[model samples]
Target chain A: MKIAVVGKGGSGKTTTSAVLARTFARHGHDTLALDCDSNPNLGISLGIGEEATEALVSVRDAVDAGEEQHATSMDDLVSRFGVDAPDGVRLAVVTAIQNPEPDCP
Target chain B: MRVAFVGKGGVGKSSLSGSFARVLAEAGERVLAIDSDPMPGMAFSLGLEQSDAGLPDDAVEEYEEDGRQRYRLREGLTGTDAVEQYAQRAPGGVHFMQLGKARGPQWNNRRQHFGFQRLLDDLPGDGWSIVGDLPGGTRQPFLTWGRYARTFLVVIEPTPASLLTGRRLARLAETARAPRVVAIANKVREPGDAERVSSRTGLDVIGSVPFDPALADADRLGKAVLDTDPDGPTATAVRSLVQTLQKSEEQS
Candidate 1:
């Protein structure tokens, strides 16, 4: 069950996402928790404050290369939506924006 | 003509937002609620099928690569047109204007404030309440909303962790000079949690909702709680919130 929680910054999203991921993982799933925060703060929410993982694949990179995804339909995108969990859910988190709008300054 | 709902993640931002738009629409407002998150929600959460109608990547690249930027703000259209030229309507009476990941993404991410501001200023005034559902991060909207939206409704959870983040967001909202800023709390299982969090952060706890299992169950079933459990406590709480917001705006 790959689930991606999307909202604006400061919305407790990363923490909620982290907590949700942990909850899913503990429910006997091999979870692939990805933090696409760009600044990446899921660590503290998931209690991995000191440890980290590579930020997930960026939507920007895929588009910049001019590669067209075969599932070019919004319906396809909708069907593929699920919580980012391993085993029970093979979640591929896409978190990078075309331009980091408020560009991490 | 645009009302933006922004807040910490999982702070009932989306729920409050959907209801807010719904209330406005029910009251005869021309509501054009938009979900701009690349992660594609709001539709399901709002009980509407999603739409892919918006700018495509290859199309954007073609315009940019050919040195023809469509969507111009100040100088008007020089080479290409604006995003509204190709905007698509989603189901449930909402016109969806998506800005998907571009082909060959914007190279200038850092300090591109002027360009970003102009882009936002250029959005077509379609005579509809432009209710935007932004991405779950501060970086994107801080730049865009500062130039685009005048009113900001932020939702927060009453937890220690959420309040800490909410404080940071309040300061940011103040600095950006958002014309109006208000905070609402979601998942309020404990009594008095909203007050404590609001005081600690020095921001108004405009609204608060008790955590409802009805909402959780709806999400588990991949259905919108609003449509599934309209009579539940969660729905009542959201209704109260919408009324509160409307009253505040009236008084202002």
Candidate 2:
């Protein structure tokens, strides 16, 4: 099953997503938690240590900086960018644009 | 005293900005609360009945800038004029304006976005104390939505996630050459909560609003904490925050 947690900032969306993902994983589901927020912190909420969470490079940054090639498929994306969180949940951060250029929507 | 409240999502940016604007207005300062978040939470905090209303469609006009389609405020309208013409009147006489809210699957606030940006760029005079409530995370700050403000209030809670985001935002503010950046610790529950936030984010804690049940209750009831409990802990703390801000502005 897929779930998307959405809310305004400071509304516990990350916390809720982490809890739900962990719960599904413990219940024998192969869960994939996607941190799609520009300020991604789902790794921290999913029992990943702060240092490791911070060290997880986002797919967009990695690809944009030429550190890694863009994944050609969903499976490739998972294997290339996903980090192992607690309870066997595969976590991947999509993108985080730290500094967007002006007039470049 | 233009200020923008920025922090991680759910970190009380709206709550503080809304309350601060009202309190500032109550003190006889002309306040314009600008909500740049597409989610539009400032109206609720400002105790305004209209939650989804934004700048009118006529507020913007199509134009070509650098051979690209763009939107700007209709000619003959200044940012101050936009406020006087379209800003909503909230409790305590605070004038509130918002970049349009997201209506559906597609982001439908483009016109409002460009229009508000243009308005902010052309805001006239120093008569109004602008309090801008930016969207959560680093996206808006990185995009320079808060560039107009003289100060950036990076609200943070005593949590790892909040601290990380706050630290990132503070750094971004500095990189953007913001005149001043300070942290306002919110939902501080423990004795060391404020200190922890300060240390973690590397920002001086200007004021700390305690974790108050009244605030939660007010949020649950879809009301502003100040309206629900005017003399409550959160309100009192916010009031003190206003005073600190004003004093610092005077000195600076």
Candidate 3:
């Protein structure tokens, strides 16, 4: 079963989503936590850590322009962009804004 | 007025927005604060105990609106009915709603996001003030999303990264035709910090929240800043910001 957590900003949405996703994974269920927020933070929140989240390429970056995706299949979508989190929970970020800084001039 | 609180991540936008909503509500205005950020936190700032910030009853079903797929509160309500039924009341009589955040397939669906955006945009404008805490950065709000707001407030900090982000955010908000776009320098350690931000961004620096030990304690303990120290420095600055905005609205 899929569960969605929604709430106002700083309203514990990430915390709730992280907890629920972790709980499901612990219960022997195949779980995935999708981070769609441009301000993505579920990585550290879910104990995935910063390095792994930084290495994650959003699906927007993964899929090539004009590339055709199977109408009903998510295999291509997951393989190219998804990052594996701790405890068998996978993470897929939909889109992320690129930070415009490169460690100062 | 529809106001959007946006800026760099972790710049106290959520706290300021929630507090501003409370300030308006306490002043006898009907206020609805929408948590539109995906990494939601406005609910905690509003001091609500709910873990699920979406509509009550796990409402994430889809429906067809105008030949486009959209998400809705499952109570079969629209507009005012939806607001009245699903909005949760917080401290100072502010009503709160969270745009739903889902995982897996639903996360990548633009239709679902747009549906929520349409709901926010279609909200009754007159006699009601809507405050949304938008996701951090310029991309999400500028790409056909900032139109939902009449005014945009960028919360910045006394740092290179945050000021640069605030500059981009301010330009985007103005480009999107937000009638009013301004900035607030948060976590100011010195009086010059706010001046630096205003000079760099060229947008009015409406408020300056000091770096208070009480606020740090509140954040570390996951407590709302206002509730932790109602008369603290940061809260006082937030109140001044709200009052200034209200006065400007009255004048305009």
Candidate 4:
């Protein structure tokens, strides 16, 4: 089953989400989760070990990037680009825009 | 163990959450972190490079599942396929994932498609742990996250405004009849901060993370606080918090 964790910013929404997801998986559920907020951090929360979450290219961004050579459907979109999360959890996220300020708000 | 974190803005929830994950990993537990916040910086906190961290170029596939609007990876791909192919591997063995972000001129059109919803529906069968970093505020929770998880964890600061947000979040979770609703007193500057938050919100403060300048500095420097200072006060508190959470899990 899928679960969504919601909260205000800086409230530990991502951290709780990460703990819960791990708890579920450790309990033997092949969990799948996605970051739905505008300020995405679930990748880092999950411990992907990267300095930043891989901002998945959205269909709209693909079209804007001029990579949509042909009309694509959801089925093909993920098969071609869906990211493989650790421990068998699949992840799909929207694209991240480059922000100028490096500081947290 | 599926839980979501919620609270007001600037309460240090993300940093605490990241530290919690690191602590768990140090304890040899596998973890999956989901960043739902739109601002996007958990990776930096997790010690991931800004350039290397981000979602894939093609993260959405909009379509109809059973004659209703739905979203997921290309139609035929299983959730496992998505995990194996797309999930980015972060430090400390934690698997990282994110929802699609709307950027540029097509923002309006992109917002209309709920690809993230589709993904939540198609999550693979469980085994490893999952953590979701939700957006800041109650508005986003109502959009589609209200009933998604069994547990609701509210993180708040000592301030009245943060406590107010926590109270609202508790009410929201209660209205939804979630199995678990708890709060964490984060960035506590005084002795009674946790008690004050608990007394105000009527939700037990499961953990209290102290104010740590070192951690704040790490954040400002764009580095994971744990990576910057694993044995610091913040990390130490997170470790204890993790233990408390684990014990609670056992009791329940």
Query: Evaluated with TM-score, which candidate comes out highest?
Result: 2
Q: Give per-residue CA lDDT, model 2, range B1-252, as digits (tens).
A: 799998888888888899999999999999989887756578888987556556787889998889998988888988889889888889998988876544456656777777877887887648889999887887856455777788889999998888988877877666666788899999998999999988888899999999988888887777888899999998899899999999999898
The TM-score of predicted model 1 comes to: 0.61
Give the higher-DockQ candidate: 1 or 2: 2
**Candidate 1 local lDDT, residue B59:** 31
Task: Sort the candidates on TM-score, descending order.
Answer: 2, 3, 4, 1
Give candidate 1's error at residue B241 in angstroms: 2.1
Question: Which one wins on DockQ?
Answer: 2
Model 3, B1-252: lDDT tens digits are 678888877788777888788877877888988886655468777877654445533334577889976665445555566567677888888888876455445546444455565566557777689888777655546545455676788888876546656765665555545677888888899869989999988889888888878876876666678899999897898889888888888787
Off by over 4 Å in 2: A70-77, B38-40, B102-108
lDDT (10s digit) by residue, model 4, range B88-149: 77788776766555555555433323555555556653555556666665543533543345
CAPRI classification of candidate 4: incorrect
Clashing pairs in 2: A9-B9, A9-B10, A10-B9, A10-B10
Q: Model 2, range A8-34, lDDT digits (tens) per residue?
A: 677689889999999999999999999
Model 1 Cα lDDT, one tens digit per residue, A50-73: 222223344435445553375486
For lDDT, candidate 2 versus 4, the one ahead is 2
| Real interface contacts reproduced by model 4, as a fraction | 0.22
| Clashes per candidate, residues 3 or more apart or on different chains | 25, 4, 14, 98
Question: Sorted on DockQ, highest at the top, how do the candidates line up?
Answer: 2, 1, 4, 3
Better of 1 and 3 by lDDT: 3
